[model samples]
Target: MTERIVVVAAALYDGDRLLAARRSAPPELAGRWELPGGKVERGETPEQALSRELLEELGVAAEVVERVPGEWPLKPPYVLQAWRARLLPDSPDPKPLQDHDELRWLTPDELWDVNWLDQDVEAVREAAFRGAGNCATSPNAPAPAPRQNPPNS
Candidate 1:
């Protein structure tokens, strides 16, 4: 059996708003919006990979607060996992540095306004459900402490 690979996605929030990134490459996925993140490289924890990816793809420093409760299947041998993340105080604003062409911050009520990638739909829903419950209304809200143990892939 082929081993499964984990793709960590960030349900990155600023206040009650979640960050969505629009793919700019890979013809099939281009133009669809999804959470910004990437694959976990061998030897790296999902949290570490997520932080690295957010910095690379969105040009910001983010802290992974907690894991979303469930996982969803992606293409064969790959699965998607989500974590709630927030920007660090000293980090720069997010930019479409790579793999994306546009970025938007959507409040809970506007989550579905953009066309989401099919594979990401359920994960976003799960993240939104969990995130909305935990999110604070003010952008200045303190971020939850990062979890000590990341969920197993």
Candidate 2:
């Protein structure tokens, strides 16, 4: 059987707001919003891949917070997963330096405002639900568990 392509996405947050990005490439996906990330490289853990991807794509350092609860299928060979994350302390605020042409911080209520790529909708909803609770309201909320490689690596 063929191995499935695993992609990891960051539901990156600063308090209650999740960062959403607009795709700038591969013409078909351009202008559609997504949680910024890319395919996991062989031998790299999901956390490592996501951190590397965020640095390359957003020009900022990210600490993957926790994996969101479920996975979604992309086109045939690809499956997507999401994690909650935060910018590393003292990191520059993320800029859309690659892959993405625009960035916006959206509160849970605004989650549906952007035109997300269809495959990302369920993951986005899960992310919004996870972030909308106490995490959004309490500045003192405990940090999520430390990064671990995504399941089914």
In terms of TM-score, the best-performing candidate is 1
lDDT by residue (tens digit), candidate 2, 71-138: 99999799999999999997899999998888999886666567788788778777777864643322
- Model 2: lDDT of residue 126: 78
For model 1, what is the C-alpha lDDT against the true structure? Answer: 0.84
Q: How many residue pairs clash (N, CA or C atoms closer than 3 angstroms) in each of the candidate models, in the order given?
A: 0, 0
Q: Please identify model 2 stretches exceeding 4 Å from their true place.
A: 132-153
Q: Candidate 1's residue-wise lDDT over 96-133, tens digit each?
A: 99989889999876676677887777777778777857
Model number with the top lDDT = 1
Q: Residue 17 of candidate 2: its Cα lDDT?
A: 87
